[model samples]
Target: MTDQRQDAIPDAIPGAVPHTRGVRFAVYSAHAKAIDLCLFDGENETRLPLNRTATDLFALHVAGLKPGARYGFRAQGVYDPDRGLWFDPSKLLVDPYARELDRPFRHDARLSTFGVDTASLVPKAIVTEDRPVAPAAPRLPKGGLIYEVAVRPFTLLHPKVPAALRGTVAALAHPAVIAHLKRIGVDAVELLPITAWIDERHLPPLGLSNGWGYNPVAMMALDPRLVPGGMAELAATVATLHENGIGVILDLVFNHSGESDRHGATLSMRGLDNLTYYRHVPGAPGLLVNDTGTGNTLACDHPVVRRLILDTLRHFVRQAGIDGFRFDLGTILGRSPQGFSRESETLRAILSDPLLADRVMIAEPWDIGPGGYQLGQFPPPFLEWNDRARDDIRLYWRGDGWKTGRLAHALAGSSEIFSAHGLGETRSVNFLAAHDGFTLMDLVSYSHKHNEANGEDNRDGHNDNHSWNNGVEGETRDPAIRDSRRRDVQALLGTLFATRGTLMLTAGDEGGRSQQGNNNAYAQDNALTWLDWTTLDDDLVTHTARLARLRRRFDVFSESAFFTGQDGDVLWLNEQGKPMTTADWEQPDRQQLTMLLKTRDREEDRATRLAVVFNRSHDALAVHLPGGPWQDLFTKDHVFSPVLPPRTVIWLRELADPSARDKEAGES
Candidate 1:
């Protein structure tokens, strides 16, 4: 062993730092009276008391320690839950900056604060060698087209993915997966959380695992089950995606951990210093501020937690080559003692940080806490998930009255809601379905949520899905019903592609994958939640691909600016081909409408115009055209007297210039 005589560096950063000697283990605990570093080897263990600094940071340089050494921290302090000072030395604590964990966490009574001995039950932090990572490529501001997916379910049923790689992060880099993503025109893969997590206490008894991976236990450590080969596997996946011009954006859950409410386990953060890591209810000591709906909300306002979050992000960016991050329950990051603020310390630090400044930042923008519905409240450079647009789109297609006006605003990027906040159309991440809600297929197939398999008596998932079952509920054998469902699915996808905002597509939506109407499949990690690759609807995939191609081809679809009546860029017309007035918008019962989108800065003297018609009424309507020779882009049918089928969306482009065809093909 090398000499351990070097001078101590005061106020050094936390976690294990590599040096010529071996490694320097350090941790921060503001209220810990004593801290011990325990190194494990087989059943044997060696404990060393770390030298405490004036700044309350504990440090120890062990000369013989090497990479892959299993280690954990034992913080000794007051175990007074009533006072919110949970520091149980018997329970081993994971390093907040641990790059890798040895095993998946198994929750037991011994892993709680009440247990006297629980070292063997907890996972140990494994020291890893730092590897150079490739620089991340620039991600599109609006993410172009974000595809949200869970890593495991997305590949488990894939016939092309190798058996060993299935349900692992490596599957994301498989050629078949990459090809499928490209086929769907996905610019970024917003992967569901891959961080180490533990199932909620209630899930194990029901024999179900959390499928969507939102319950993160360690923000920095990749789940051993998901990435069996460790960070290198994730890095390889990111590199593969980047090579194909696709960015990887992780959906991170920093708002809460797998450690549930006060009665939850004594995990890493809680064991180390619960008083500092979690936000407590203002006068009630043991009561945690449960803004995340996951029992305890992380105190992002605290300096220590703030640093941990930023460091975790930088680690992913620099070590795994992550292009961006989509914050789950993003409102928590901007919440303060008073309420949610755009200038919150954590939010500001993330925006101003050099390492993350250029990366794409998407926000879920809401939580179950007070003042948590901050949809248009996040500051600039942050794209927010537009739930308003989602709800309005569902309502409009469901044939709800007074929805046409709301649908119009949503398709136009909900400018009325976001514009005043200085957010452009691109800042709205619009989607008809997401991981938390119904799949696209379920959106039109089922009228109610079927979450009985989740073991909560079907009371777990969202009750108000705003979905329509067409003329029949659930799956049907009737050809007419199937055709209607198919048509509605196509219409919804086409509308999403045409809308002016950052479009997000759930993984299996393009292939018509259904979850049997289980909106909240968070705890059903079975075939019910997995994609049925063999039964993927090819026709639906083709239609979705066509829409994606159109979105890429037309500049009008992804324009940043909001439509102004004076710009001549867009014209709102009623089914009669006349310019619409306020009365047209106020007609709650009217469902037939048309949007004349004039191509931006075309080479022709008169710009090429495309009229998108939406006929949501039950009967077919003869849509009057705006006095121009038009061709149906889908059927190539000439629009002499355009008669649209009920519940149909048709796109008609002007054939004034013959060269327009060549331009369109070249653009696609």
Candidate 2:
């Protein structure tokens, strides 16, 4: 091992950045007494001491180091768990800014703080020089459709996607995958966490791995298992999506790492400088604050952690050409020593960033911490996941009483929440289901979560699903029940598309994908989570496609402003064909209503007027039509008075002029 330092000084930042001659490896450890750069050559090892800067940043320049070189770090400091000073030189550490990993993580006790000589058990970081490039695509448009898909599950069973590119990021660029996205009228594809991650320790014992890549150890590094070609492959995928006019948004988990709580492994951040990297309990310095429910919460309030996250954002945006990001457990980003603040330095930095402020930014908006639910509290330019919409829509369609007002507020872009933020309905990303809960199919098929496969004895997932089994739970052979389930699914989806706000569809929901009632299938890497393309429901897929087409063609769904009611933009009516009164709205037995929407800023286009009738009762509803020649949106047939069947919906459009009818007929 050579103990030497090159002439050029390294940058006082984290990660390995390639320079003109060689690579400069920098790491921040404010509490560390010594830091060593370990270079691996096969089974042999060479340790070189790093030069400590005045800012407590350990750095070293090596002339021969280039891209793909495997390396790790060994931080030496006082080991005091109660005081939150955990550092051990014997345990190998990963670079928080690593762009790539040599291989997937294999769970071992030696990788923790209690083990020694853990050199071979840890994943090594590979050096890479990222070149600056312009963004391949523009930011997503307002009220665009965002499709959430897991890379592996989405393409693993595809017949057209090449087998070589099946479970990786490159598969997203395949002609078959791109064709499916375009056919669904998807504006943006939010790829779930592709960052290098570690399978939870308990999974291997049960013969499972985290199919969803939420437990990330390295933020900048793309997991080799997911992206074999690294950033090059990711860049190409982004470029292709841009060429096809579809933007790419990444689902990032910066709230926590794969490292668990006090009993967790000593991965990258924990071993580097645990005291400064993670937020310790206010009084009990040894324990971490469980804000994210992931065992450890990142100390984003710290300057070093802030810089690391910001650099990662820029790296992905400028080098990989990603259009935007959807932060997982995003509440942690705005959290501070006191609590979550809209004016936190971390949140301000991201919103005010020169390179990132204009890009599409989304937040999950809630965590498991105290006062974690901040759905409408996020600042401007951030679209939040609207769980309120999810629950209210589910409750209304599930035949729950006294939910009309809740559904109405949600359908209007959740104005009650976003209006106070000086934003409109477009600020809420509305969806029936997301990656965390029951899928759209399960939302109607199972009333209880079947998570026994997760090794938690079916006690791990949420119990209050607000779901209706229609008639039977799990699989049912009765064709009548099957038809009812199908109708219910259609109604939920129809309501979602007909509402005015941004829309998100989880992968395989169009074809009625289910996890056999498992709501939290995070650890199931096999058939349970993989999207089965073989037995797709053709009718359901067609219905979803039609809804997408409607959402895209109508201007009301994309309106940035809320309905003023006086401009004739919106109208609410009861089953008696009269404006709904306070008494009518409060009636628990009322199960049918009509919503009329006028196209925004397009009064000249008479065909843009739309009316939707929703009936959840057991009997058919007779809806009186407005004075116009109405045409069924899905059927393209003229109708005077329509009787909607029980538990069904009807969407109608006005064909006022002959030219409008011609245009409508042509579109149908």
- TM-score for every candidate vs. truth? 0.95, 0.95
lDDT of 1 by residue, 26-125 (tens): 8888888888999999868789988777666777888978998999999888988899988888888888888899998876766664757778888899
Clashes (backbone N, CA, C under 3 Å), per candidate, total 0, 0
In model 2, what lDDT does residue 179 have?
88
Q: Worst ten-residue run, lDDT, model 2?
A: 1-10
Roughly what TM-score does model 2 have, to 2 decimal places? 0.95
lDDT tens per residue, model 2, 143-204: 78899989999888888988899988899999888988888888999999999999888788
Once superposed on the true structure, which residue ranges of model 1 sit more than 4 Å away at CA? 1-7, 141-143, 422-426, 600-607, 638-641, 658-668
Q: What is the C-alpha RMSD of each candidate to the true structure, in Å?
A: 4.0, 3.8
Worst 10 residues of 1 by lDDT: 1-10
The list of candidate 2 runs beyond 4 A from truth reads: 1-11, 136-139, 422-426, 600-607, 657-668
